[model samples]
Target: MIRPDGFDAVVVGSGPNGLVAAVTMAEAGRRVLLVEAADRFGGGLRTEELTLPGFRHDVCATVLALAVASPAFRALRLDQPVAGHGPPPVEWAHAPIAAAHPLDKQPAVLVHRDLERTAGELGQDSAAWRATVGAAARAGDPLVDTLLAPLSLPRAPLGAARFGALAALPATVLGRTLFRTERGRAVLAGMAAHSMLDLRSPITSGYGLMLAALAHHVGWPVAVGGSQSVADALVARLVANGGEVVGGWAVRDLQELPPARLVLLDLTPRQVLAVAGDRLPPRYRRRLSRFRYGPGVFKLDWALSGPVPWSDPSVSRAGTVHLGGTLDEIALSEAEVAAGRHPARPYVLLTQPTVADPTRAPASRHVLWAYCHVPNGSGRDMTEAIEAQIERFAPGFRDLVLARHALGPADLEARNANLVGGDIGGGEASLSQFARRPRYSPHPWATPVPGLYICSASTPPGGGAHGMGGWQAARLALRRDRQA
Candidate 1:
């Protein structure tokens, strides 16, 4: 039976952003309803025994670097202890090193939490490495706050300006101009590849700088049990603050929902159009249609008999590994995907969660999570290419796999409807797309229909598991509610 009493606000979808929005609104004394299509609450925060029963794997996002640094998450106090949960709010465990970028002939470049240690390992380019990443790290939370929030006049304008000037250059230009050694260049290239754009594209340097700085600011850590623990923490906080979540309720249309003063959508533009296209103005609909998506990702989960035997033993010390020989190789691979082709030796991002969090796997066993860029919606399987790349770095990597599960573009989209064509970063992170997102407007979150707003990763600070988009939209909704 449908309840006649409508909520003060209804948040569609229960991703990190949606959960944050619901929590924010509920905390403000509003009766909120958080809805999800899946049986689970977390969107990308799911964990499953995909390959084997004993080994647990993160289905999507594994790292919590961005989550910890996000203003929205910080405001919610997710790092603190919750009443019901055994661990503190999102218990995190870090490896000795944050990330390792391995090359063919030289020692792998390791990114340690300590900036000086990371720089010292770069050999000839140590000074240049420190000047760029170390300098950004020194700027610290103020710099992070400026980058994570919506595009606006920053509180620390000088720091923002300095960071912006350097961040605007192409990753290729930054690598070639600033560093001479493959060690430093590979590290920066690995970071930039996270943007899923061509390394030559403008503002690609920003991705590299931001990720590198994050490594120093907060080491890339995983939730104690799995990524789901992060979501569980958020849910615990939300429930404590009076928000309620209804799982397995797939909202097909906005009109079908119970009456509410505000509706926050955690969906991307495509899904939003399907649900509320008729109500939206023609101009807004067109803008949403124009919202471009980037390259897709081909992911893999492996139940390993043992740890990946890296040629460089130090590579095992890090939680995440970037496997592609050098800067030029990674650039070529990324460029191939952007041009709608798959590289034979694709650049791969692999995370061995068990290294830091032992609870993820049974004793003497390990779990490996990895993915590589593929052309959007491409049906071709790149498991062979990906495994081959890992094998290149860790000679007998394939031998350690007791079982493996692969998700191509279609599989990824099927699991999470928001991952349109498997383009994971909400939408393309291009300079034009970054500024305009769905469209160029002062209030990007607001729609033509009153009381409706978009709070997906497609908004400002696009992509990653950060909850800023939902937080920004909810804050806006609250302001409008006060005005009403």
Candidate 2:
């Protein structure tokens, strides 16, 4: 229970990271209070009837591959149900095919849960795929643990070394060098584009390689009933652990927060500067001011009358689809966005949750979501361009839309301030930011301020549903308290 004086720890935001931090502290027998400015607990883990009634859409993150593999969530037992068995707090619903990439002329390349099956499809490059991505998968959870927390010592040094050797190269270089087949390279391009970085950028290969390995390790699944269920489950875990959560409480400054021995901020550098700039030392604040955010996104959600009628009927069986012709096309699109110019044919990412969990839509109806990268803080509407791209692959796609909702970078930031100009991966995923997120430090989470820490997506392991930042912060907080 919280003491009459104050809670033992107070978390300022309720993103996946914040929720994890609160849960960590509360379960450790500390009095924890989690506060959010939004009406609900989840930050990016939000779901709403974005397009129309009865058509629930994930506002941001939908895939649970990282959550399923996260050590933090695993420690919290998020994958399991409470003893009695009504249902698991967050039921994972997976599509038969994890992901697909369609070509202008050829068949769509598919990433199946079975590594061998996916490998076999690559034909000539099958051995290459098995050697690189498959090697990481064989290393299993330990390698993933090290990747997610790169600063930590690897339990599998050989695995990390081997993975890092390939991981260090640009996706363009790795894909072309490693895979001889166009099909193999195209699939790698599709996965690498998730980085939102130029395919030529260093460590972009690492992003793509990690995701491919995860598809084999844990099939990209969605939280049934919407991604909100994941947030609800985390909140329930916190409450059960005697932690308190208060929504619609915005903290504009450090003085606004309640008395607590520790304060963990689940926010980016921009929000931190707004709320606690005065409290931080000049050098730390200066570093945060110089932090860079990568490309923003133009998001579109649709309530469809039926499934997207892809030219490749098999594409409907996959939960996620990448709609860019080939590696060169995708690379060019990303390069355009990076150069502050929107591509006429942007590399589009589409997700159909109803494929795996029909509960997202009404009856036989469906909902489709697609987004394309753009310059940070862009205001241009890409609705026509995006729909045209979808129609290019999925003929009659326009006829399927019952309603549509679009959000530019600004709109996204307005809705959830953490998204800041719609850079969803949380501040650039560049190699430099990965190591010196906010600022270089032995423990970045622990700010110079006493009893204060930052555990946002801006920290190491950069972006994803994994709560490693919070897990690390909470561990540090606990250790410090013991010493004091």
Candidate 3:
């Protein structure tokens, strides 16, 4: 039984963005309703015991670097501890090291919270590392603020210009030109590979630099319990602010729901077309149909008997680990995936939550979350390849796995509709796509359908757990409502 009235604004999804949009509208004194297709509220933020009881695993996103730095999240005070949640605070647990990239013949390259410390570990490329990642790190939150929003004249012009100059180059070119040692290049390359773009692509360095800067700005933190705790906190705040959330309710048609003054859809382009295709103009529909999606991911979760036995001891301290070896190796692996081929040694991004927050698993046991890039809509099982890559850096890793759960591209899509073809970044984060996501309207969130808007990761500041897209869209809706 669906409510037929008394809502000023309606949000179509309940992901971080959707939750943010609903909360924003509710805080603005608007009667808001948040609808979710899934049984759970969080889209990427959901956590589950995929392997065994008590061993919690983040279903999609694990790290909270971007979320911690998000202006929208900060404004909502989500990082603070709520009165009822717990005493330890449902905020975040910063790992000792942000991330560690392990190699076969040398010590692991660790991204420390201290910029100088990280650069000092780079050997011959220390000066260059200081100039690039170190400088961005010093820029801090201002740099993150600029990158996390739509492209505009930055408030910190000097820092933005410095970041832009380096960000303009391809990761491969920048890595080769600046770093003399493989360790330095590998460290940066591992960060860049998160883009899901080829290393040779222009502006790939931007992703690398942004991620590294975030590592220093706010160490990659995880929720106190699991990612679900973050969602629970957001939902609690939303409800506290007078918003309503309805789960297990999919909106196939926009008109099916109660009439509202504004509708903010936390959905991708393809989904928009499905729900409101008849309401949109022919030209707008055409633009959405042509929207591009990037490579997919093959995700795996494990309930381990013991910790991953890494050859490098530092690897155990870090929350996140990049398993691909050298700069060239990661570049080759990313290139292969983009070209629709799974590499024999794929780059694996692994997160050990139990290392930082022990609540995720039982005593002396561990939970491992890892994923590797694959072609869009790929059904191939890369379990063997992924395990082999992990074993390359961490010996006896397989022996520790008590149970494992794997999700291919299709499985990811089945679990969450927003992850089209398993692309967790909403859509492709290519330079061209960044400029015109879905379509090139001046107000990207506002659809041509009068009161409808798209506020998912498909909008500006493309992906991540950051709720900027929803926050921006909610602001737009409020502005439009005032005018109306």
Candidate 4:
């Protein structure tokens, strides 16, 4: 349905954020053209038979976190109205085990969505877990709005007060005060590790607790086939709304693009400046020039002969499995990664889709998804190390692996130029970078050039599966386009 004569708006990437922005713009009646550098349209939402011909694997971002919360996604009815019938548990798979971290030569900790049950499971430290996560979850709407919204805008006074009250506590202290059992503490630390921050660091626990609460409030559900289905759903919306997507044409420079009233760069700041060159303001250029990228990752996809034999049987039922021994052990591993060396036993996150959706593989054979945090750009193939971590918990892990494929930091960057050295969250998620992300500019989305805006994980809310950055950037672009 493309007009073939340029467009009112053009998006330069096909990542989730880019697609969301394009869909939003097209929905507003603008002629939007979306361009992708890869052969296929979806970015992180891509799926392929990496390990085996029949098994499918998510290239990146397995869990659907902020996608469900996105106003754009909800309004579009992205994944609502469950289609064909399947196993009742598979329909939603609402239960996620928070206390499912396997220990070295010991019993694993298990946390379910039930707060009282989770507390009783923790025994002594249950009160702290209940209070911290409970208080936050009870009032998550405002907190989430503040957390996910662009920091460039003035903070809502009431929301700011609530966030400030919550933010005032240190994550370490909060964890210590909440749960006494090592299992309970480790479970919470594993959640905090999602922040990509030092485990022992303060405030890093907020995202984990908030997200865990969200999982309990609204289960961490994935599409029936894989994450690619989610992207396809969004792309369908874009096309239905009369938008165009150009696949297989990589955008190396911005000037080569056709004329348009506004251009939204759904890329990291580095890629933006590289493509736009002198079109950017000197001050804007300077700010972007100083933007930082965080630690890299080593991702692996596996075709298993059978499901993961987790020490705790319940771990198999949950969508996400945090696999770094105890809370203290995970903290040490994360600290090691933060210290610029791969952990002796890296923190591993695993998701087995075939368990939930049988379509992912053949019969009982399954597709196992896992990734571990490594020093940014580290080329070390820690496949053995990761396998060892899994084997420690799942004793026969190696025997079950039918085939495997891996991507190092360099490989990740080559796949998506925005992942500069495998910094998936766009740039690192630090305090200074979170609010003044990409730069100290009051308007994070607005560039010095009137019609240009940076819309990616590099902006506020740092990184996640969420498209709030795109939504905020689109709002800014739509407003500016109207004024013009």
Candidate 5:
């Protein structure tokens, strides 16, 4: 059944990485075939009706802040109308407030799209906030281009140098030492906590600082309908460039694939070890096996009768909310998970898309999804703890739930094998892993297996929806093909 001579290249696993790889090859005049194991195309970008009918929910990632800020996506110009393709299908929706971190005894700390406005509310921490997060925002695309390609020579060395000055520090240390205000420290803690690492872990501050910068520079946004629109748009771009997508076709082995000059696997090390089994050299296989995974997550999605009744009304206008109180509280919660125990009060990263795009639910109703870090592969249900954290900030939150869906680590893995025990960032973003991700090389995407490349988040500049990993991999493949 295989047309062995039809395609010049094949990309397995239809994630952001794989999709981007296919698009890049096809655009460069290669006959490309993109394959997915799932019935759908998007990996983390998928959307589904998880609850009652008509109440749509993002199955995975919702926020497109990185996508907006990404140099890879910027080159695609998805916002602009292509010459023959007409206007792009994707349009971003923005909430009044980008993010909020609510506290028990005070008004929530809000991050507005306007930098000065966000800093103005921080009182004594205003200038310090501007000096760090503001400076990152001002550095903008040049710095983002450099940061997204971690192993490459810095395009903006001055900006990169400035960033490294603060990035190497732990979030806990940076928060306590750099900023004096509790509001400033607490907000940074909330952003850094997204890394799913111990708050005291090195380079945790980088995650927090970058997120805060994105909020100011791009303003956190989601797609108009659901995040799936993003996947649709990317697919449209691919099809326009003559790439064919074959969905629901799982690639079990290299032998199953049609003959192609190049094969790009958008998979983590675990899947790579399985699919490319015995084909890889013993030493390379061992390195793939040795790749460590990070913390898992417990996810909850709710169809609400009405908007969350946040005690602080301002929080209701925010697209995203961090629900673990102060800097100390968040640090402890993340540390508990890092130490292999679930915190009684887990740090909940909640997003209310209806705040920005109400089309997700029935009229006057709303849809909400949240997840909290857990020990890797842990099966424990965190429904009660997650809801309690939500209730802590938004009173009467439980009453608003028309229906709810909960998925533990195992459930996430069942739905998407790439999740691999629900370590969604693809693998640990630890200091050592950051330096030598899945085995370091000048070209991390290229596997020892000639004509094959690995282009998942497991490589350098790990995780997030930015497609730099795939873009970089495809570019390298093109270069290699030219040389060959």
Candidate 6:
């Protein structure tokens, strides 16, 4: 075949991180090409007719909180409005105000978006809730600014100092001190449960707090149509800036790539090794092999005839909902998954996108997105378990389900190889992995190969649709190319 023009940078995968890397490079006046293995762009960010033709569903992440918190977005001049998704209103809703403890006479813990209202409702734990989330909100912008930016700040000293102090807090101290009431603790613990780590684990509390802070600062809102809108918008920006995206290209080896000064991969470490092979340094290869991957998940999508008849009306108003009953209950569920045992009671992360965006389904129909923590690569369909959980809080949940589909961890991996063994968050967000993800090299964006870099969720900040990994990788590649 005839040769195509050599581009300045090549990005594999068209997920949020991939698109972000492409856009950042293109914005910097570099020739960029983004390649996706799938027929369409936007890997996990796609919206499809999984249930039925007219009804649409989100494939993976539906929340827009991380995108909002990302510093990369601020530089893009991208406009992503959250209010349009009925944020803080139709988007948010409560499961149950009380924890359904087996035999406890005490009521279930409640989670409310409004800090003051939430505090007032908490019988004894009001002070703790106001202290942590309340304090974090007060110090939110500076904290987010520091975390989102690249490690090398090329910064106002005052801002840097503020961010430094905030980042220094230990996980347990932060969580335990913030929300005192069992209900408040449960709410925060539930947020932390997003990680596959044990609740009482040293670093996990921080991960939960970090996400919770963002939720409080920028309400966890879904995209107007679905998360695909975000992918489309980024791709649009890249194409607008002269970047090209080729679909259906499964990159198997580095040598197969067209000549380019820099190659950015939006894939996991395994893919990197598979492609790069012996080209990578021995130490780097060994470290990549030793990298830890987290537990998997099972997802369920429901086409509800109407909104989830939540007993706690507040949950119905949230853009995203945490569906584990109590702090201890959630912790137990996570613990079960960690031990490789599938728990009958699993903690679920759920959302009702149609409540916020009418485009997701017909006028009267609604789309319920949900996922529960499960053992790695588990092939168990969790539709019934997930529905049972929902029904626990919304008694009549099963009656409203018009259609439903479920995907086990293995199926998730089949769809996205990056999610190896269905371990999303691009592997685990353990302490070491959080900052030095994939490998412990100073420049996470720079791979052992001179012209290659990893720009996926497997990189720094480890997971979510923040796009930091891509932005960082692309920036390094463009800068390195300029120097060359």
Q: Rate the local accuracy (lDDT) of all candidates.
A: 0.89, 0.90, 0.89, 0.76, 0.90, 0.74
> Which portions of model 5 miss their true places by more than 4 Å?
1-4, 81-88
* Candidate 1 lDDT tens digits, 145-209: 88988575575678778778889999999999999987788889999999999999999999999
Residues 254-366 of candidate 4: C-alpha lDDT, one tens digit per residue: 77788888888889988988998998878778988898888888999999998788886767776678888666777788788888988888888887776667788999898
Model 1 misplaced stretches (Cα beyond 4 Å): 1-3, 84-88
Q: Per-residue CA lDDT of candidate 2, range 1-484, in tens?
A: 3346888999988989999999999999999999999999888899999988899999999988999898898898776655542335788999999999988877899999999999998899999999998998888999999898877888788899999999989999999999998899999999999999999999999989999999999889999999998888888888888888899888899887779999999999999899997888998999999999989999999999998999999999999999888899999999999999999999999999999999999999997889999999999999988998899998899988899999999999988898888899789988888888878887888989999999999888788988888888888999999899
Runs in model 2 deviating more than 4 A are: 1-4, 82-88
Winner on TM-score between 4 and 5 is 5
| RMSD to true structure for each model, in Å | 1.3, 1.6, 1.5, 3.3, 1.4, 4.7
lDDT of 6: 0.74
Q: Please, what are the lDDT tens digits per residue for candidate 3 over residues 14-107?
A: 8889989998999899888899999989999999999999999999888888888898888888766656533334668877998999998889
lDDT for model 4 comes to 0.76
In terms of TM-score, how similar is model 1 to the real structure?
Answer: 0.98
Worst 10 residues of 3 by lDDT: 81-90
Q: What TM-score should be assigned to candidate 2?
A: 0.98
10 residues in a row with least lDDT, candidate 5: 80-89
